[model samples]
Target: NAGVTQTPKFRVLKTGQSMTLLCAQDMNHEYMYWYRQDPGMGLRLIHYSVGEGTTAKGEVPDGYNVSRLKKQNFLLGLESAAPSQTSVYFCASTEAGRAKNIQYFGAGTRLSVL
Candidate 1:
């Protein structure tokens, strides 16, 4: 099974353009997360879900939204993309409880905004 998958590995957007990034996992994980990686900084969480149909805001949630409609899928949306939002987006998942400490990440999606 595909451990974790991210769609549209690369994208270029103009200011104010909106886009949705998709994340899917076949591991049946109980936790899912969205993170952004920028130059010279550790990955920052954008949004996360504890389980299907449940979501929460993360450290950098502004200008972004997330939904987990199914146990294997998580979606991140940017309503008005900005240059500041351009970064490598990563999706990760892990098992519940004790196993949660270990997360598997998808190949990041690179986004550039002009």
Candidate 2:
């Protein structure tokens, strides 16, 4: 089973252009998250869902939105992309509220905004 997969492995967007990144997992995990990794700031959470049909804002939710409509999928949408948003995006999943569980990440999507 594919643990997690991200669409459009690489993308280049002009300022203000919008795009959606799709993530899918087959692990039947209950917690899914979207995070952005910059050069040095480490991974910052953008949005997360505890379960299917539930979504919540995260540490760096600005300029991004997320949705979890199916148990195995999470989608991130950038309505107005900016240069500052040019970073690697990773989608991760873990067992819900299982304190002993660690997150498993996707290969990541590289986005560049000019």
Candidate 3:
């Protein structure tokens, strides 16, 4: 994907509630990924897709799922919300054949679980 965009800039969910974060990219990219940033730790991968219609688990896949039915869109879904899941979520995409593998990131979605 080229330019990434994420919806729902901020959200607050009660325990057990669920929501889906939408990520869209303008250009067609082979690889797309989702990450979450906490206070101290660096970004942690939540899920990723190699191509359209293919998704793989990432470093922090628990409690989350991803879908890439279209080449320019990726969706991150939370089956249920928890306090530990509250964080700033980011979506990124990069061209697979590029040497630099430079990724374009979305503004981010801030989720707060109470």
Candidate 4:
């Protein structure tokens, strides 16, 4: 079963272009999250969904939006990409309400906004 997969392993965008990154998981997890990893800082949460049809803003949700219409899929959209948005995007999922359980992450999507 594919644990987690992200579309477009790499992407380059202009300062104003927009794009949507797709994430999918087969684990039927009830919690899905989107995070960005910068040079030295740890992963910062962008958005998360507790379950299908439910979404919430995360630590760094500005300039981004998310949707979780399907139980296995979570999508992150950048309405206006900026150079500062250039970072490694990781999608993660975990079992519901199991804080002890570690999140399973996708390889990552490297985005560069020029």
What TM-score fits each model? Answer: 0.96, 0.96, 0.95, 0.96
Error of 1 at 11 (Å): 0.3
Q: How much lDDT does candidate 1 score?
A: 0.95
Pairing residues by index, what is the TM-score of model 2?
A: 0.96
lDDT of 3 by residue, 28-114 (tens): 888999999998999999999989999999999999989999999999999889899999999999998749878899999999999
The C-alpha lDDT values of all candidates are 0.95, 0.96, 0.94, 0.96
Top candidate by lDDT: 4
Candidate 4 weakest lDDT stretch, 10 residues: 94-103
lDDT of 1 by residue, 1-114 (tens): 689999989999999999999999998899999999999998999999999999999999999999999999999999999999989999999988964278999999999999
- Where's the lowest-lDDT run of ten residues in candidate 3? 95-104
Q: Candidate 4 at 97: error in angstroms?
A: 2.2
- lDDT string for model 4 (1-114, tens) is 789999989999999999999999999899999999999999999999999999999999999999999999999999999999999999999998746988999999999999
Query: Of the candidates numbered 3 and 4, which has the greater lDDT value?
Result: 4
TM-score, structure 1 vs. true:
0.96
